[model samples]
Target chain A: MTEPKVKDNDVVVPGEELASGMGYLPGQGTYRDGDKIRANRLGLVHIDGRAIKLVPLAGRYLPKSGDVIIGKVRDVTYSGWIIDTNSAYRAMLSLKDATNAYIRKGADLTKFYSFGDYVVVKIFNVTSQNLIDLSMKGPGLRKLEQGRVITVDPSKVPRIIGKEGSMVSMIKTQTNCRITVGQNGVIWISGEPKNEIMAEGVIRKIEREAHVPGLTDKIKKELEKTNKGEQ
Target chain B: MTYSKRLDGRGFEDIREMEAKVGVVKNADGSAMFRMGKTIAYAAVYGPKDLYPKFLQDPERGILRVNYNMMPFSGMGDRVRPGPSRRSREIGMVSKNALLPVINLTDFKNAVVDVFIELPQTDAGTRCAGICAASLALADAGITMRDLVASVSIGKIGDKLVVDLTYDEEAIKDMDVADIPVAVIPSTGEISLLQMDGIISKEEITEAIEMAKRACVKINKVQVDALKKKFEVKKNE
Candidate 1:
């Protein structure tokens, strides 16, 4: 009998293992001795077939239509508010979308989103000219209060967060700190001053050594050390 | 009248205390910061992205763009603009030309490879160090290319060529006019970047290039060592 082939863009559940990447399966994807398959794609793996099919994880953050992101209000324009989305392009959040309530024409825009205020917003539209239109209406999308923000390498966010939020969940459990890990490497940690410090330290340590192998062990060791000292 | 070598208790060709680091900036796609003695350089690579305009896009391969900037505090005496200057512009263009020969641009069609170099300190061999740092950063960013590029500046001073020159040495030495900065792909013995400043006899230029090539080969080992050490530390962590 012939082995089943996995198609591209196929969604698979986790723990299924990946059989091959898109197009053609590379020589390394196939196991020499058994039917086991190595993951070719970087996403959820489905093991429904005799072999495993790979489903890709969430793609990198592109300013998609109606997607919500927290933006830092940069410059206030006469007609709109310019936000730095931490992307290559700057987004404009007009006063019309700044709030659900009606905004008067030429009204004071600062009342909605003053400069440097972080606001959760949705991308209403993205133009070919790299112009991004934003709105401030969405669930769990609102202004962020006083919190310490730290940046990480965006590519390493997955590794930092770990599988199914296991890494961050462990950190929160250990430090007793409320942590928000933004997709764009921006993290906000808030809680008691002591827990906040511990969480920030752990995050920075991970940020510094995230590229290293055996990171899970390192994070586990760090949290254990912190726990011992706290106890 | 003066027959003795300078303080630091070293010969003219001796390199100063060298320390190199990779991946300093978190935001850059590829980043490295290296310092040799007091001279420091930070390089960032963000590219293989879509080209801006249709006319500027290359159908066959990616276009490499390099920007070199000397921060105002790079020097003790003169503060330069934060942006690119004439010298930096020329250096950037030359660097781009140098790297293009090593990078497989065709892999990234219709995209642009942009490299930005920031020199936080100024010395005689800033450009050469900048090139080396940028190469390492590119490698750290996982940009598959040809072998790593290594560069060094050798100057003729007091009728002898030195491997690396400090700011004071370059400024004070007016008698020897020839200065050659060469970049080599150490693995393949390929000459990707070569530039000479000041007047020198053809024989001296050839000698300098040959000497620089040998120095570049040694420098390549250090580059490999730095990258390997970085990964080794990561694996242990």
Candidate 2:
């Protein structure tokens, strides 16, 4: 059998040949071109069994169904609210899925969610043309209030959240802040003035060093150091 | 008068001293700066965001829009106009076509990806430099691309053939000078962009393209290095 040209976690650019054998299946950011696997984007190589894929390092947030996101209400239409999910496509949060309350149509829809308000929403449906359908009727999905909102690289969201929320939970316990990380990279933090600022700094640090080795250990140490300073 | 030696005291196929850097603009989705000889080009990639004109939006794939601008004082000659001109407009369109073959924008439907190339200093080969920089920025932005496009100017100076032309060589009054800006996909040897000014023999055109393809192979190495260096920084440092 022919060997793979690239190993796991190798930095690869577009058009670089990964492997030229039929034994490999092409995954995201990679394609099979006449029995040769080639990368179609700049990312790290990930070999999963018979499939080879790439983990992107940068790009705009791509909206996906069943993803919780933080969005800003750009326009309040007659039937629903138009939300900007920090993506190329806008999401429509209809009145029926917006809230459990039953209200009459054409009677001040902005009363529920007005313009420029930030809300936590869950995308329920996405069309082939990229039309997004949002629903606010989920656990912990509501309009954010009095919290500072910031954005990070969506590609690093999984790292910031850590493996099964371990990384974020550690930060929350140490900083005593409530942090909501959106799959789209929008984050909301609310807590005491001093702790909230600390939480934001930690999150930004994670974003910067997401690709660094021993990232979890480094973040844990940094959080403890800040906690000692506060004592 | 016969021309035997190059005006810059360099070999015919030699490209000038070059340097490239990526992620120069902090706020842009992806950005880069490329400098060759006296010419310098900066390119920034933005969007895949909402397309402004509703009619221009395509349901199948995103569109690429390139804006090429030469700063007013970039050239040694008279000041260039700040806004878009006929020359810049034509270059922008050609540059867009130059990059379209390599970039895959199918993931972003009904959106637009904008690449802005600004040159603060230039001697010659300005559009070619801009194309090289834009290709690097697009790849750095993590746009799905089949390959990176590298560009250089192949000049036919009098009876001599040159890989990259300097301003002095183009301005030589006594002999015929032909400037050909060509962009190539290094992996495939496909010429995505070709533009010519002045005159050259039919047989010499093939030779010029081959020379450019070689120079572009060397230039592609620099582009690849600039991107890798961004992520290579150690976290402890």
Best by TM-score: 2
- List candidate 1 stretches off by more than 4 Å: A1-69, A77-80, A94-101, A104-107, A122-130, A133-138, A212-231, B1-19, B23-126, B137-148, B153-179, B185-192, B197-218
Where is model 2 more than 4 Å wrong at Cα? B235-237
Assess the local accuracy of residue A92 in candidate 1 as a C-alpha lDDT between 0 and 100.
91
Please give the distance, in angstroms, between residue B147's alpha carbon in candidate 1 and its true position after superposition: 6.9
User: For all candidates listed, what's the TM-score of chain B alone?
Assistant: 0.92, 0.97
In model 1 chain A, the worst 10-residue window by lDDT is A25-34
- Candidate 2 lDDT over B1-237, as tens digits, reads 557899788888899988999999889998999998999999999978999779999989999999999999998979987999999999999999999999887888899999999999999999889999999899888899988899999998778889889898889998999999999998789999999999889999999999999999999999888888888884345
Model 1, span B59-150: residue lDDT tens: 67667888988899889778776765688889998888777776766555566767899988877678888888888777666554545677
Fraction of true interface contacts that also occur in model 1 = 0.08
Give the clashing pairs for model 1: A43-A57
Interface RMSD of each: 11.1, 1.4
Question: lDDT of each prediction vs. the true structure?
Answer: 0.67, 0.91
Q: Model 2 chain B: which ten-residue window has the lowest total lDDT?
A: B228-237
Candidate 2, residues A108-161, lDDT tens digits: the string is 987888899999999999998899999998899999998689999998899989
